[model samples]
Target: MGERMFPLERQKKILELLMIKKVLKLTELTEELNISIDTLRRDLNHLTKQGKIEKIYGGVKLVESKFGESTIADRLISHIEEKERIAKKCSEYIHDGDCIYLDSGSTTFQIAKYIKNKKNLTVITNSVPIVNELMNDDVELIIIGGKVRQNEQSVVAYEYLFNFNELNILKAFIGASGITIEKGISDYNLEEAITRKNMIELSKEVYVAADSTKFDKDVTIGIAPLDKIDYIITDGNIKKDFINKFKKITTSLIISE
Candidate 1:
């Protein structure tokens, strides 16, 4: 027979349960694992140290979770300052007259806010809000036509691909469902991944704008490999160890303060 697991394995099991479900009370973990209260506390501490979950009054929940099926408004509040800081840093990379593609995500939307005053820039995107943000600006906006995804406030369909195919973009600011050295880049939906992949292929440089929470979570579709990425712009709360891991995978990693 195989060797029995230690307390750490038991704690990992608890986390697995939390990931698949929504929330779990301390009593549930202790009762199911048959562990003492003190041992359970130690397990929770271990997982917390690893940035797996947050400890609550009687239970633990995933640290980077959309709790209680949180709406987009709720998520926008979670990392507002960090995203604005990242937007400022990304703004430094854009120059006058650059042809850029902006992807649909909270962080990238913040970048759109920063680009409003910019002049003579050409923006190509399938994000409805982004197109509207630049509509009255001195810049030229080429909105890729596609079927709209209302929840995401963006479009992802074959017509969008047709728009992308004919254009030569200077840079692409996009997001991923997950970023890992192993899987590279992934998205939760296949249709979204298709549009993202086309943008990556069309752009000379691809910059991924993600908050710290998007670091380890794996979604369902594969978009691109690490070899295709030029930079990653994220927040300060990301552990130094994880940032270093990505540095070894890509050349430049900009982590905002």
Candidate 2:
């Protein structure tokens, strides 16, 4: 037999514990909440069903819904203002006739918006939308050929890497799932990670464009090591301690207001 849902106070307390400790095992939650193990399980099950948390083996963890999926539509809404701020900052790096590589991302797409009117620069990318964004501009648009990954709205395949190897990209603007002292940079998708990694290697300057929410959260796929990143452009809400920690790894950290 199953169990009934706990009172709202119990649910609030569960969320509190998750925020404080980051993760809680079934037994741990039950003991801390002074509830039966079965009741705790039911609460966890309910929370998971609501998308408030995720079940990981013997434990549960708070998973921000923004990090829940890497779809283009999901990303388009997750950090709209922060992306705009970062995109504005990226424009200062652009100059006429400068060759550039824009990594496929919702944030990078915003960068594309700001760069559309510029002339005499080469824009190379695997992003479908970016190609369309600059197609009418005088700026030369180079679309790297590969299999389309529709969810991210980008291309990535062995063939794409082969094509990427043949070109020398000048600058790269990439995205990340998380930046950490321990785990370095990572992404939610393995294919996106590979594409970002290759872009980083091919470029002279690599800028990671992420929002405040991306800080301190480690996802599964490793994109690149922290030392390899030249700039991290995120919104101002990133914790000072985390930013200070990043200072040890990166020389330039641009926290947009």
Best by lDDT: 2
TM-score winner: 2
Q: Output the lDDT of residue 90, model 2.
A: 87
Query: How do the predictions measure up, each by TM-score?
Result: 0.69, 0.70
Q: Which digits, one per residue and each the tens of the lDDT, describe model 1 over residues 114-198? A: 8877778898887766766667788788877778886566788576346556798999998776887787778776777888998
lDDT of 2 at 195: 77
How many residue pairs clash in model 1? Answer: 0
Candidate 1 ranges with C-alpha deviation above 4 Å: 1-74, 159-161
What digit string (tens of lDDT, one per residue) describes model 2 on residues 43-142?
A: 7778888887898988988865455575664565566888899888887788887789887887887788888777788888888768766778888888
C-alpha RMSD of each candidate structure in angstroms:
15.5, 13.8
> What total of clashing residue pairs does each candidate reach?
0, 0
